[model samples]
Target chain A: MRTFEHVNAPDVQTAVALLGEASTEAIAGGTDLLGELKARLRSPQRLVNLKTLAGLQEISYSPKAGLRLGALVTLAEIERHPIIQERFPILAQAAASAATPQLRNMGTIGGNLCQKPRCWYYRNKLFECWLKGGDKCFAEDGENKYHAILGADRCHAVHPSDLAPALIALDATLRVVGPDLDGELSLEELYTKPTESRRQMTILGPGELITDIRVPIPKNGSRGVYLKTMERQSWSFALVSVAAQMNFAGERIADARVVLGGVAAIPWRARDSERILIGQRFSEGLAERAVEAAVAGAQPLRDNEYKVSLAKALVKRVIIDLCSTTD
Target chain B: MATKAVRAKKLKVAIRGPGKTAIKLTVNGETHELLIEPRRTLLNALRKDLGLTGTKKACDEGTCGTCTVLLEGKPIYACMALAIECDGKSVETIESLSKDGQLHPIQRAFIAEDALQCGFCTPGQIMSVKALLDENPNPTLDDVKRVLSGNLCRCGAYPKLFQAALRAADLVRTGR
Candidate 1:
């Protein structure tokens, strides 16, 4: 890692102020940022240590207020929290399924959501992909197996977050504070395709920092499940994952959310798939239909057409799991 | 760079180093003060400066768990943690395992179970086991596999490693 000045910011205001300067970035658990630093991918002149900020490490939940997770809360903390395990099991499952125990102890939710893509071209200093301001993206014609099948614009790198799809399915929002941005923004709104103008995945502006994640309490009789298919049982990124949340009223599904990861530039919400479930009764045939709609418009690259089928299978399994037995 | 960190309030939060700066680290119940660069990782500080090299540095990045250590009683990759960030925090490394020349229970169990080959990954593997048994005295086989999955042993002594973890649990329980 390059030698740099470290500032342990005493408050959010101070951290934001420090990040406002050029070539300065915020360090939260350093699980992701430190790797990027050591690999010489991004060398900031100064680092503002967000760990010193007060009140960012607490997790509190109430029936009326839902859940409020401080940005600094580690993934293990989220995975092991009693309320999260009992009430928001999908989020807990997602956290537990992510990286190993050592990493979960060190990685924070904010860092997980903000971590860089695992694209080989992007991480290697040898290739200057378009995401790094190059003329073209090598993943387009090269080893494109892990690239996105849906929402493949200029960059084809898939979003590598496990918590993102789960949280987005639960309709989570984030409170922000910064010199350029402040207010609450939905978790889905945080991700955007990397455009030529802004070659970054997230829409966060300079000095913007995520303060807290707010999840609305699920309505009664709601079922949520997160299913991920990886090459290995553990320590592997999801080849295709699905997060399905639905509220059952009597025999009909009142509301539904189906989000897909590892198939898009962002946590791709399957609204068409969700529409097939909501306002309808669960049936064996209905699950197949929802699964079909989930991957209807996917444009897979040469080596990644298998993800299309994998994604459909995962979505169907999740829908079936959520609607297996109605109370 | 120094001027950017100055603020009207919170004067106690000083900007430390583009160079060496003073910091305190508590390792194995002993506190030591040293001057180090802010970029110095805890792994290097333990092995080089403090002369405590029990924590191996196999894959320095977070992928390999050779440098695993307990910070505030939670297992974290020492390589991923900065020494400056560990100020006033307690770090428990592999060197702290034995007491008064008697090998720790986990170490003794590993030897009894013949759980090592090259022994390059033993210290880290033992530290992870110590962490697990500290929380869960009687872990199932699934729990043992999942926790030891991060610490890769190229020699593939996984069967014995599993036995060692279970044996270490028995040793602790029986006060051996």
Candidate 2:
């Protein structure tokens, strides 16, 4: 790892100010930043330790106000929080399905959302892919198994977070703090397609950081499910994951949210699937139609054709599981 | 709580540099003050500065759990953690599990179950089991698998490892 200065920010104000400096980066849990540093992918002159900040360290909830999580809350805490597990279990399931226990203990919710792409070409220092301000993306035609199938622009790297799909399905909002931006923004707005001008996954400008994450409590009789497929049973990134949440009014569906990961540059919201699910009761035929709509316009790469069928199957399974859930 | 209306003007943080800086680490209930660079990982500081090599380092990235250690009683990857960041926090490594001459129950169970082929991953595996049994005294088979999934035993001693974890839970429950 390249040597750099480390600063313990006394408050969010100081953290923002220091991060605004050139060749400086923020380190929350260091699970993601340390790896990038070790791989020499991001060589910063200074590291502002966000853990030293006075706030962004608590998980609070209320019946009327819903659940609010500080940015520094570890993934393990989310996986084990009683209120979260009992109320929004799909979020907990997504947190639990992430990296191993060790990484979960060290990885914070904010850092997980802002972590860089896991593309082989992007991570390898040898390949200056388009995301790195290069002319072309190597994953376009080379070893493109994990490339994007939807919303691929200059880069095809998929969003590698499991919590993103789940939280977006839950309609979570974030409180961002920065120089020009300090307000509530939908979690979906945090992401962006890798355009020639942006060349990044998120819209966070210089020194922008998330302070709080709020997930609204679902209405009564609502059920949500997060299902992921990996190469192995455990300790692997998602091959294709689905997060589906449905709100029920008596016997009919009032509203629904369906999001897919590992299929697009951002958390792919399956609005077509959700549209099919709204105002309809859960049934095998409805599930089939929704699943078909989820992958209608997918453009899989040469080596990633399996993701299309796998994503469709997971969408069907997630909807079924959400309707069948008793608790 | 800080108000959102407060604008970030200039930083008041005392910065430690690209050069060596002073920091203190509490390892195994002992505190040591040393000067080191900011990039020094907890795994390297423990092995080199503190001479506590019980914690192994493999896949220096977070992929492998060979460098697992307890930060504030929660298991985390040491290699992924910066030593400077753990200034006032407590760290429990594999060396701290046993005291005097008596082996920890998890270590004894690993020996009894013969959970080793090359023994390269034993320290990490045992530490993970210790962490699990510390939190859940009566861990089920699935719990054991979930906690130890991070610590990979390339020698393929998983079957015996599960048995050893169960046996360790029993040994601790029986107070033997």
Superposed on all Cα atoms, the candidates' RMSDs to the truth, in angstroms, are: 1.6, 3.3
Candidate with top lDDT is 1
Alpha-carbon TM-score of each model against the true structure: 0.97, 0.97
Residue pair clashes in candidate 1: none
Please provide, for model 2 over A178-277, each residue's C-alpha lDDT reduced to its tens digit, 9 standing for 90 to 100. Answer: 9777899999999999888888889999889899999999988888889999998877878899998888877678999999999999999999998998
Per-residue lDDT of model 1, residues A209-307, tens digit only: 999999999899998999988887888888999987899888899999999999988999999998888999989999999989998888998899999
State the number of backbone clashes in model 1.
Answer: 0
Model 1 TM: 0.97
**Model 1 chain B: which ten-residue window has the lowest total lDDT?**
B1-10
Fraction of the true interface contacts (Cα pairs closer than 8 Å across chains) found in each model = 0.80, 0.91
lDDT of 2 at A22: 77
For B31-78, candidate 2 gives per-residue lDDT tens digits of 889788999999999999999999998899988788889888888889
> Candidate 1 residues B28-83, lDDT tens each?
99999989999999999999889999999987888878898999988889999999
